[model samples]
Target: MLGKLFLLSLVCFFSLNFLSTINAETNLIADEIQSLKVTNKDPRMINFSVSLTEDHNYTSARLFYFLPNPSLNKSATRGDLNGIQSKFNNFYVDFDTNKGITGSRFIPTGVTFEYYWEFTDVNKNNYKTEMQQYLFLDGQYEWKLLTADNIFFYYYGNYNKNIQNCFLESVSVVKDGSDLLAIKVSYPINIIYYLSPSDSRYAKPTRSIVMDSMTVLGGVKYTSNVVHSYDQDCGVVKHEVTHILNEIAGHGTLLKLPFWVDEGFATYMMNKSDYYDNIIEKMINKNTVIRLSSMQGKPGTPEKVNLYYAQSYATTKYMIEQYGLEKYRSFFKILKEDFVIDEALQTVYGHDQDSLYLEWRQHKGLPIIKLVKIEQSSIPIPVATITPLNFPSKTTVNQQEVENNFSKQNNSNELAVSNFEIFINNYIFIIVGAILLLIMIKISIFLWKK
Candidate 1:
């Protein structure tokens, strides 16, 4: 009976030892799966592993991958105390017999992100990790990726490929009296230009125009597309930089000034000689001259648009010439303070709106027409009258009276007739005397000759 009891106890000891070995093996597998390794191929796929442990709080976890083309993808797996989440079916045992899993995510070409691993074991332990990578187009032109402290600036395309060379040629970042500003040629991005599909009207309308040249936007960078034609004259980087300064000085408000003023300021900073000439020519040609009032908002019509941009350039030039740079700088401050166009102008220039308009008009050689009224009820008229009288009753008149009347009438008629007769007689006498003188002279001459 003692031998039987000993054999039973030994069997129990062996069973307990076998169970402890299995538990130790499971714990060793869990402890070995401490970290995950991630690898990215050219097209972007993610592979990683998660260690399962007890005492973690979360039962499942997710991993996110960012693509370059504005999209993201995620993979999720369940957590296990001794086994990985069942969702990761491809999971297998590593060389050391730890849990291993691999999966892929299709993200946009340029997508980027920071990732944190979120999971809770039976013991409530959490984990997070950050990763970085960039997706580039597959072509002959390879881009040098740049990232500084989580901020990234991607350079692509021909110009972008030679960014360092271009930067050497055109860019300058200067520190001036506690201020920093970078002057650089900003190449255009075709994608950004086409990004605002809804605002196509404001974008380049024709392939021809798009081919002509790229334009600067938001005063921050220059933009161009592959189809742009006028590439050589894109040296307006300084002009845009000045606008950035002006915008900042104005507290990031354009103050609803006319487009002319806005552009004029930019052009003025670019150097106004050429712009001034153009504006003067336009003014002389009676092209649209933007009024301050008219330039208070976005230019709507084609005529106004031309005027807005041209006049903006012109007026900004005028301001520089008349007000000086210091005053021009102060004008922005005034605008920021008042936020009223007319009031700002008056405060800065010491002139009212109408007066300013008159000045601008005069400068442009435009005539101002004013309405006037006249009154016409103050003239006097001259008067004249004639009266008819009946002949006096002759029957009762005495003969002497009748004779006197007839004699007076006859005397008046005879006076008139005598002046006529005298004139005729004088005329006849003068002719007769002249004829007699001629006859006597002829007779005397003839007698002498004989």
Candidate 2:
């Protein structure tokens, strides 16, 4: 009976050990299944799902996932079967992941899933935005598997989300002859297109354009029709850009350049053609005849607006052509310092305001005047003559005086007749005869010893 009891005890011990082994195996399988994990990365906090497919031979696993919006996020979500199903149906992801299950034939070779979530607020009211993410698998004793396919799939989702959020407010395709063009501006700054008709004369506000139709001042991207019949040259846009930059760089604070100078600079930057060159030449020619001082600050008359624009453009062009950009820039700089426009020109060009006009006039072959003066106070007066002792006395009547007088008269007659040619010339005979008579009188008195 004791031997029988020992054999039964040995059988009981073996059965208990078998049961314990089976329980341990089951627990190990459970632990391996629990080790599988999935992750999603997105800029926007969106819900998504990931599914795993296993191979019976433990060779590889398939991951199926879906991304409804790939533009904003870069990740996938994993949860209970029902939650995963809900997200998967809404958002779709491509197969990515290749890992084999351990000890068991089941492996997650790929994932299939979906997501539903909102993206972060990208400040794209006036501009567009873009986004990306990474994913790693936490498996039991699987060396922490990571695959690019999975990560890339999430990136695609983020990309798609951004694409969906991106929307163009207005688009314009302008045709100029053989050229095809398109211009688009996004939301927020929609005022660019809604400029008042009056403003159109001055500037083009930020707005939308279509083919012959325009929607200005709308909250959404304002659009307008392309009016080819009324289309202006692209230079018009340049003019508008200048105004925008001027305002944005610090509006009224810019140096108060004269209207002509300001407008001329804008025109130069906008229109650079032979036509403009001709206009400048005309202005230069006109300026040579007219003083710049006379032109400065002169308001345009009703009929002279076109003339004013042309002349202003010419003057500014001349300045830029003669004085390089450095000096041109300096001109504006000085103007900014609150110098009067004329004063600024004088300071930079090394001439007074009026002188510049004169120089320009001269350069253009215009008439100029010069004056001369004579001084009369620099002449000297003649001196009086001295009388000699032997000179003849006209009132003397003595025999010696008479004889001297008679001899003087005869000598004077002889001396006067000496130059007969002088007598022949009427004027010369009068001058010579008088000189000879005075000499004869002196000689006669000396001969008489008086």
- RMSD list, candidates in order: 52.3, 51.9
Error of 1 at 383 (Å): 74
Candidate 2 TM-score to native: 0.31
Runs of candidate 1 with Cα error greater than 4 angstroms are 1-141, 144-232, 252-260, 272-276, 352-354, 369-450
lDDT per residue (tens digit) for residues 1-450 in model 2 = 554455455445555544443332111122222123334331112223322222111221222222211211222222111222222112222222211211211111122233222111122111101111223222211222112211111111122332221111011111110011111221111112211233222121221122103112111110110110001223433333332222222112323334455445545554555655665566555652233444434233322433554555666667777777667666656655656656677788886545654565565566775323222221222211100001112321000000001001111121212223323542554455455555654554554453
Encode model 1's per-residue lDDT on 168-240: one tens digit a residue.
2122211120032222223222111111222222222221232112222211222111111112222233343
Candidate achieving the largest TM-score: 1
lDDT of 1: 0.36
Error of 1 at 136 (Å): 11
Backbone clashes per model, in order? 32, 63
Error (Å) of candidate 1 at residue 256 is 7.0
Candidate 2 residue 378 C-alpha distance from true site, Å = 45
